[model samples]
Structure formats: C-alpha cells, structure tokens
Target: MTCTLENHRAELASLLKPVFDSLGTQWLPVTSEQLCDRITSEDTFAVLPIPAFTNSQMDGYAVRSADLLSAAPDAPVSLPLGFTAAAGDPQLELQPGTASPVMTGAMIPAGADTVIPVEESATGTFPELVRCGHGTPSGQAAFTAPSPEGRFIRPAGVDLAAGALVAPAGTRLAPAMIAALASSGLTEIPVRRALKVALCTTGDELSNGQLAEGQIPDANSPMLAALLRRHQVEVRTIQLPDDPQGFVAAIDELQAEVDLIVTVGGISAGAYEVVRQALSPLGGNFHHVAIQPGGPQGYAQLGDATVLCFPGNPVSALLSAELFLVPLLREFNGLPEPRPGHYPLAAEASSPEHKHQVRRALIRDGQVTILDPGSHLVHDLARADALVHIPVGVTQLVAGQSIETWSMNV
Candidate 1:
C-alpha cells in the first residue's frame, strides 16, 4: 500500500538488506589468461610475472660511493674508464681502480656501488695513449680529491618489495592493476556471480508508442530498462495489458526466474490500474506515496519477488527508478550507499507540499544548473545530467543553493 516517504524508504531498505547481506557470493577459479569482463570477482584470477632485469634509469659513471667524498669541482679526482655498461646488459664489474660508464636501468656490477652524472666531469681530451689512472694522477693525487659514487644506482627492490598486495580480493582490475598483480605472482582470482533481473512493462498503449486517440507510448519501461543496464544490471523485458488476472498470472510465472520485478504505470487510483490490481492479489497493495508527479508509486511482494511500481509518466517513472532502484542495486551488489553529491541550482523553482523535487539540469562550469524550464515535463527528465533533490519542508529552492544531485550515468 502507499505510505509516507520515510516508510517507503524504510520498506525498501528492509527488502534490499537481505540481498546485500546474503548475496553468498561465489567464485570460479580461472587462469589469468582468461580474465576479460570488468565485473568478475577480482580474486578469481592470479598472474605469474615474467621477471627480468632490464635497462637503466640514466647514463653516468658507476663507482664506489666512498670513492667520491673528497673530490671537488676545483681539484677533481680521476680514474681509468673501465668497460661501459649500456642500457640493457647484465652487470659489468669494474677492474681494480677503475670506474665503469653505465647507462640508466643497468644492473650495478658486483664491485661498483654508485653513479655520478656526466656533467660533473669533463671528458678530458681523448688520448692516443691513455694514462694508467689511480686516486687521480699519482702526481695529481697529491692535489685532487675523490668523488662519491653510491647515490646514482638504485638498489634492487627499491620500487617494489616482493609479494605486495598488487590486486587483492575484490579488486577492480585495470591495466596497472593487472601489471602489479602479474608482478606479484598471481594468475587467477575469485569473484561474485552477477544477479539476474527481468523487466515487465504494463499497458498496451505504452508499448505501441502510438499517440492515437488519447493513447500514450510506452516510454517508461524501456527507459527504466536502459537505466538498470547502465548500472550493470542483468535485465530482460516483457509487456502486459490492462488486465489484472492476466498480469498476475504473468507475475506468478516470472517470479521464480528473476531477483526483482519492476513495472511502469497503472498504479494510480484509475480503474485500469492493472499492475496494482494484479500485484494486490499476490500480497501487495497499490497506494499513493506522499511525493510528487510520481506520488502514486507502489510496492509489494509479487510472489517471491518484490515489485517496484512507478507512475506512468516518463519523468515520474525515471524519477521513481532513481529514488528507489539505484540504491537497491548498490545494496544488492554489496556496495555502500552512494554518497550524494551537489552542484549549484541552475535556477530557482517551487513545488507543492513536502515533495522531493527533481528537475532537468546539466553540469556547467563545475556546477549543476537548469537545462530547461522547471516543468514536471516528464520527457525533459531524459535530458538531465543529474537530479537536484530539494529537501523536505523547504517547498521552494532559491537559485544558487548547492542542491544535491545523483548523477544519471553513475
């Protein structure tokens, strides 16, 4: 039956709590090579990293750090150049009393401990007969100091200690996550199975989408389907007419197959409110919610499944979905209720009673502003980038107040 806003929210929360709490998630072990879809339980796959030592961080001479402490720009120290280590080679040990020219990312030789940038010393004119250098020229050793060599070469495991939490259970893996996971030696993970949903649209006129002789097209059902899908919900659809018995039979038939049932229209006090009438026979009652253009919302058990009913108007249908369905999705998926975010109101507007108002608005200059006239203009809701929630009792919103909006594509 219809109830206060608070009651409806409470009812919804209760019905949804078990879905999140008892999801009883399962995992199927699969090879890392098989990981594909973004929603798989991240724990199901593990990766085995292909490890190899590679290129340098930069090019410079590698030496022992203790060797450079006394060297200065004025009276520089000098040593014989040993074999050069290029970017990708294995470590090249320095001969006794010699410095090795090394590229970035190269492994340090067993004996060398540091690197000094090339800018610190001059190449000193190429000599046909190179001098046997030690602690600077022996004659110059009396005058020159030694330069430090330890700062340049990065020690092994500096960037990553072994066995890190690259991608733990429940991780949402991306390229970087994959790289990290592979690096940490994993190949598979276990994840939760997806929940299945079915959409049953009521009213023949709405389905036809033909505006003939006061008839209306069925916009709400399809729109609702799209919204659910955007949230990664598994959904399918069926349509019904304005006959209570037939609709009830259909609900009876489908309840065993889906986790939830959502219907659009025919919940109001009107005579042809077949969805309400149909659900009423199966443990539910159709009643008016104390809200707005969509106040005529309904809910009840449709056999084993809970049915969320929305007003027939397109805006009302979508608004109802936003207010009720999205939150349920979050709970069912074992995720926290989304934090409500806000942007400035585009323009000031007023509504009747203590109803929560939703209007068409887009994000402009980092703020939410009205996109169209503040009309209950049902169709206009489709154009909205966000929903501006007017709080209870205010009855009016002055422009520029940073009202809360639940993003549409979230």
Candidate 2:
C-alpha cells in the first residue's frame, strides 16, 4: 500500500526497532581527543575535582581576606610580597602578614583565602622583586580596597567534584564535555561502536569512472556514503548491475556482515527495477511514498540485516536518506534528532495537491529561497543548504510566508 511520508517513517521505525535492538551495544575505548561526537556507552565519573585544587582566577596577589580588611582608598595598606606562584608551581604555605604573587590558574597557597587582581592593586601590576633580610625575593603590594573571602579564587571542586558524574550513558560527547572529562584526569572513555551499513547503488547505466555513451557516473553511491559517514556510520559501498539475480547474489553475500543494507536506484516501477524485483519475492514492501523528489521506497529483511531502498534519481535518493534513513540512524546511534526550523520564504512557491514537495533551497538572512524542483537537478541540489517542506494540499505560498525547513548541511 502507498504510505504518506510520516507513516512510512513510523513503519520503518517499527520494523527496524528489533533489528537494531538485536545488534546490541559494542563499546570502544577512546581518548578525549578522539571522543568528540562519540556517544558514551556507559556512565563516566570524574577521577579528580575539575580544578583538582584551589587556584587563583587572576594574575594577582593571594592573601588572607583579614589582611585587606583595613585597606581603603584613603588608607592603603602595603604588605611585603612572598614567593611568586605561577601555574605548575608547587603549592606552598602563605606566611602571615605577607601576600603571595599568584598568576592565573596558579595553585592558591595554603592559608590564602582571597585574590586581589593585579590591576586592582595600587601599582596596577605585580611589584618588582628585591632581596629581603631572609635572602628571599620580596616586594610590596599595596591594596586600596578590602577583598571579600574567596574573591577571584577558583576553589577545589567548584566546577566538578571528585567522583561526580562526568557524562551519563547515551550522551553525545561535544568538545566542551571532552575538555571537562580530560581535566578530570580521564585518559580513556567508553563510546558506542559506529553502526555498520552496506550502501548498495544498483543500475546498469551507472558507472564510477570513464562513463561510456548512454552511461552516467554514479552519484548516489558517493552521495549516500558521505551522508552515512557524517553520522559516523561505517559504510561499505557495493555497486550492482540492473540484473535481478546478480543483485540478489550480492546482497546475500553481504547481508550477514552488515547491520543494515541501504540501496539507491532500481526501486521504481520501471522495467529494470532490480532492487524491487529481487527483494519483493523475499517479502520486501515496495511502494510509493507521498513525497516529491523521493516517492519510490522499499524495505525488506534479509536474515539478520534490514534493507532500505530508494529511487534512482540523485535528488530523490538524497532526500530519502535525509528524511527517512538519517533520522532513524541517528536515533539508534544515540544522537539528537535534527529539528526542523521555520523560515520565511524569500519568494513565492507552489506544490502538488497530493504529495509533499520537498524542494531544495538556500537559507540566508533568515529566509528560504526555493531552488529548481526537478528530481534530476543535481546541480541545483548541490547549491542548496536546506530542504523546504511544502505539505500536501498547499498549492501556493506567498513571499514572506513562514515555512518549515531542514538544514541540509547538518
């Protein structure tokens, strides 16, 4: 039966849910540098506090708050400065009645409860060192204002405490999260293994190189491969001829090795529709989906693997992957679903009465300008950064009318 685009997605979800669940989880150990965009397979904990130790948040003086209590603009108090504490310096104890020069991120010495930024000091910078009676370099730091306790100090565990949850299971690690995890002394992380897919593009007229007369260079294979790779899916490309028997043989050989098999081309009602011809006898459901550019869609189960078939046109295959396949793939991979954004139309547009028209468009200046609506317009598709969705029964759209768009660059 012909299904609407929404119904097709729901059906695909229901059919593939078990196949994905049966695949189970495989975890890999990865370093913080390799963790970006990887989904956490298990709960991760902080090995140490984020700061690990109290540190100065500014290049200034670390002093006891009581020492600055009497200092004011009219009655500035000067105290001898002790050792300089730069980042990576060993922690030391602050002597009474003396201020310690501490750089930003420097460990705050014991007994110091406040930091006075160098800019706020009387000299507006660190004082020069001189020899003192004890043979240690010393300098004077004058404060004109009292510093409250803990001012400009990043206390231990202020950002994250020891043994705290760093990232929970199913969390997609971004760069900032990786930084936090690395700062907590985590050297290795557990991330879910990438989903494995076999990308098959079938058509006798398609060639990868040196196309002869009546043959076209295969765009669907590479295009779909890139889309799959963007989602971190491990894809193995298989180019099949229009011969149905040969197609079945190729699929049978790879079905056991992959979690899902995605085929582009040869799924329509044409005479050479190898994908539909080969898989339909094996219980594949091939039907038209109520969507422009991509109407012919099919799915079948081949033993442990599930198959998803798209039309032959480049634009149709691309939109099919974006709308139907990518979302489900992201869902199973623990990634967030791509949310649709609404933008005003830059110009007037129209759609058919029965099928949702998914037109390529350029979104700029908060407006979406629809491009050529033809399914064969690969050049136009290349220039598009978004897909503007005009639903069924909406025949016309006026300029400045807000419409839903899905970013193609995502």
Which candidate wins on TM-score? 2
- The sequence of per-residue lDDT tens digits that candidate 2 reaches over residues 18-69 is 7666654555444634467877888999999989899999999999999889
- Cα lDDT, model 1, residue 130: 18
Off by over 4 Å in 1: 24-56, 59-112, 117-160, 166-187, 207-218, 240-257, 302-304, 330-348, 360-379, 391-410
| lDDT of candidate 1 over 38-112, digit per residue (tens) | 343443322322232422455666676666666666756677766667655666666655666666777666687
Question: Candidate 2 lDDT (Cα, whole model)?
Answer: 0.86
How accurate locally is residue 46 in candidate 1, as Cα lDDT from 0 to 100?
26
> Where in model 2 is the C-alpha error above 4 Å?
22-34, 66-78, 129-135, 144-146, 333-352, 362-372, 394-404
Against the reference, the lDDT scores of all candidates come to 0.63, 0.86
Backbone clash tally for model 2?
0
Estimated TM-score per prediction? 0.67, 0.86
